[model samples]
Target chain A: EPEVTQTPSHQVTQMGQEVILRCVPISNHLYFYWYRQILGQKVEFLVSFYNNEISEKSEIFDDQFSVERPDGSNFTLKIRSTKLEDSAMYFCASRGPTEIHYEQYFGPGTRLTVT
Target chain B: SQQGEEDPQALSIQEGENATMNCSYKTSINNLQWYRQNSGRGLVHLILIRSNEREKHSGRLRVTLDTSKKSSSLLITASRAADTASYFCATYVMGFQKLVFGTGTRLLVSP
Candidate 1:
């Protein structure tokens, strides 16, 4: 079964530093998303991307965050300046044909730790 | 601020026993999905039940949706030790692609 893949399984950065998380969604998927899970907490939606534009974003996805599909296969989330509270596990997900009730496939996730 | 919330923060059972988790949402949804995540890993899609559908099944997993009550339940029968994981319920609100996830139920199955 094809699955979403993300790079940099774990990252540690200092406060005020920048970090880029990359994901390669399933080849045929049309919709992509980014979510974060603060240690032992519920998963929180950050942003959704479709057709090279942001479809919707949660309040957690503020000015510090931005997502881009720079190529047909690569989708990335960039954090301008990391903060201690920003430490969490970031997951990338994708789904095919938004009209149908298809399940979203999630990647293994990148553990972001800010000091 | 959480749209979906699950009950019984944690559960434990024997290998052959059954496990059930419940989720409640605050608003109307297009569809509800259940996912499982092993320790420190990504989520795996388990099942999806639309608002119009009352019940759905896949192998040993059964999912029931009660849109009128804004609640849903997931049942896993004859579970194995490997089935131990955190289960989450996510709701896709109407007119959008975002999915709001609930606090997960942590299941620990002993062999």
Candidate 2:
């Protein structure tokens, strides 16, 4: 089965530094999303993308956060200034272009450690 | 927060035992989905039950959704050690446009 893939399984960055998490969603998927999970916490939605634009976002997705589909295959989340609270497991997910009804396939996730 | 809440935050059972997890939510949803996550890993989709469906099953996993009650349950029968993972219930918001996941139930199936 085709699955979403993310790069840099682990990321360590200094506080206030910029970080961009990359994801390659399933080739035919039309909806892409980014979510985060704090250690021992439930997953939180960050943003959703379709047609090269963000469809909806949460308060957690502030000015410091931006998403881009630089290419047809790559969806990336960029944090302009990282903070200690920003450290979490960031997961990329994709859905659609299948017969299954409304299921998002998640990637292995990138563990972001902000020090 | 429109997040779902799961009960029995942690459970431990021996192999061949049945494990059941329950979830409740506070909002109207289009569907409910269950996912599993190994320690520090990503989520694995388990099964989904639409708001219109009362129950659905896949393999040893069974999911039930009560739209009127705004609750769902996941049951794993004759589970194995490999089934030990954190199970989460996610609700679809805005007609499948977004998902709100709940605090998961961590199950440990001992061999």
Candidate 3:
């Protein structure tokens, strides 16, 4: 089974620095999403993308956050200026056509630690 | 602030025992999904139940959705140590493209 892949499984950056989390969704999947989970908290949706554009976003996805499909295979989430609260497990997910119904496959996730 | 909330934040059971977790949501939804996450690992999709569906099953896992009450439950039968993980219930609210996940239930299946 093809899985979503993310780079830099663990990232450590200084506060106020810019960081981009990269993901390579399944080749054929059309819908891509980014979600984050604070330690011991529920996973929160950040943004959803389709056709290389944002379909929807949450309040957490403020001006500091941006997503890009720079290439056919790469979907990235960029934080213009990091904060301590930005430290969390960021996950990338993709969905493709399925016979039963649609389902999003999640990647292993990138643990972002901002200090 | 709109999100699903799971009950019994944590559970512990022995191998071969059955584990049950419950979830409740505040809004109408198109579908409900369950996911599992191991410690320090990413989430794994377990199952999804549409709003119109009452129940669904996969392997040892069973999920039931009651739209009237806006609640769902996940049951894991004949559990094993490997089944120990954090289980989350996510709801896809109507007219939205993103999912809102609950706080999750951490289960520890002891060998």
Candidate 4:
């Protein structure tokens, strides 16, 4: 089965530095999303994208965060400045067309570690 | 205490036994979904129960939704050791495009 895939399975960056987490969602899916999980915490929604534009975002997705679909298959989340609290597992997910929008396929996730 | 919360943060069972986890939400939802995640791995979609549906089954997994009570349950019958993982219930809240995940219930099935 086709699955969402993310690059840089593990990323380590210095505090105040920038980092980009990339994902290639399942082809043919129309909606894409980004979520993050702090160690031992619930998975929190960051943002959703459709038609190459942001559909919705959470408070945690402040100015520091931005998402881009620079190409047909690549969806990326960029954090301008990282903080210690920013360290977490960032997951990328995609949902099928309208008929199957309820089910989302998730990628293996990129573990971001900011020191 | 949040939008989505699951009871019994951890559960232990033996092979061939059954496991059930309950999840509660605070708001109306378009649909509720169950997902499983092995340690350090990606989430695997299990089942999704729509707001209008009372119950749904896929293989050994069963999911029930009670929109009136804002609660849902996931049951794995005759579970195997491979069934051990953290189970999470996520809600696609009404009028929202994103999914809100609940604190997961970790299951450990010994062979």
Model 2 residue pairs with clashes: none
Instruction: Quote the positional error of residue A6 for candidate 3 in Å.
Output: 0.4
**Residue B43 lDDT, candidate 3, scale 0-100:** 90
Best by TM-score: 4
Which candidate, 1 or 2, would have the higher TM-score against the true structure?
1
Positional deviation of A78 in candidate 3, in angstroms? 0.4
Q: Model 3, range B1-111, lDDT digits (tens) per residue? A: 347889789999999999999999999999999999999899999999999999999999999999999999999999999999999999988888888999999999999
Candidate 3 chain B least-lDDT 10 residues: B1-10
- lDDT by residue (B1-111, candidate 4, tens digit) is 898899879999999999999999999899999999999888899999999999999999989889889999999999899999999999999899989999999999999
Cα TM-score per model? 0.98, 0.97, 0.97, 0.98
Give the Å shift of residue A2 in candidate 3: 0.3
Candidate 2 residue lDDT tens string, A11-66: 99999999999999999999999999999889999999988899999999999999
Q: Once superposed on the true structure, which residue ranges of model 4 sit more than 4 Å away at CA?
A: none
Question: DockQ of candidates 1 onward, in order?
Answer: 0.95, 0.79, 0.91, 0.94
lDDT of 1: 0.94
Residues A1-115, candidate 3: write the lDDT tens digits: 7999998899999999999999999998889999999998889999999887999999999999999999999999999999999999999999875423457799999999999
Separately for all candidates shown, the number of backbone clashes (residues 3 or more apart, or on different chains) is 0, 0, 0, 0
Interface RMSD of each: 0.6, 1.1, 0.6, 0.5
Q: Chain A of model 3, TM-score against the native?
A: 0.96
Pick by DockQ: 1 or 4, better one: 1
| Distance from true location, Cα of A52 in model 2, Å | 1.0
